[model samples]
Target: MIGLCLGLAGLVWAQVPTPAFTLAWDHTIEKIRWEEDYRVTPQGLLLGEARVRGSGAGMEIPEGAELKDGSWRYHRTLPPLQPLRVGRTPEAGDYQLCFDEQCHVLSEWLGPPTAEQPALELWSCAQVE
Candidate 1:
């Protein structure tokens, strides 16, 4: 009975969800567009992107954007004056943008902006998965 209990406990512990990785970037890259590619991997979800932007606030990379070899690629018509590296672990909280073998961006609070700041903020979210 004790062995069975221990096995059950082990199963339960293994079932516990892993924490998401949190990544933060400057608020400036919010202007440029971004994309994410999702894939299934042994490590849960893998995210990658083709482009990222850099600005004064810091750096802005697409959320849920795919990552490869711990690095991502960003492209622009005009070579980025400055590029910011993306792909850091995320924190939990039902993020507005999340990547888990798939890209999903919350649409509830997402819509057209009322003001310039709101417009920019909304644009920033659009870049996320």
Candidate 2:
């Protein structure tokens, strides 16, 4: 029984993939900051925290949301993906980060980070204070 339990746990852990890279954005001019930690698994992509910044509005998205067609709701249901790309996600030219309550539009394309860039894991939550 213990061995079977261990096997099941291992199987579940193996399926929960970790992200290859971190993501972040700061539109300080508009006082907007977005940070997300994500990973793609066989089931779909998983997002954590999804902390918000800049919008005095206190918008919060519950964790454990899956990335489906660029959108995730309070429930874990996912949207649809296009070909090899996950829908509604940032790419190079077309991307949309829509949370349960708020959405932050992103470019589909991304460029290399600059020296002035802050650490991905620890970007400031709020530009003001």
Best by lDDT: 2
Off by over 4 Å in 2: 1-20, 56-129
Model 2 lDDT per residue over 17-116, tens place: 1222234454333545555554433333444445444343444445765444443433433431111122222222222334334443332222332333
Predicted candidate 1 versus true structure: per-residue lDDT over 45-123, tens digit per residue: 3343344433234454546544554544543333211111222222212122333443333222233222322211110
Give me the overall lDDT of model 1: 0.28
Best by TM-score: 2
Q: What is the lDDT of residue 78 in candidate 1?
A: 31
Deviation of model 2 at 7, angstroms? 35
- What TM-score, computed on C-alpha atoms, does each candidate reach? 0.25, 0.30
Off by more than 4 A, model 1: 1-30, 60-105, 108-129
| lDDT at position 95, candidate 1 | 20
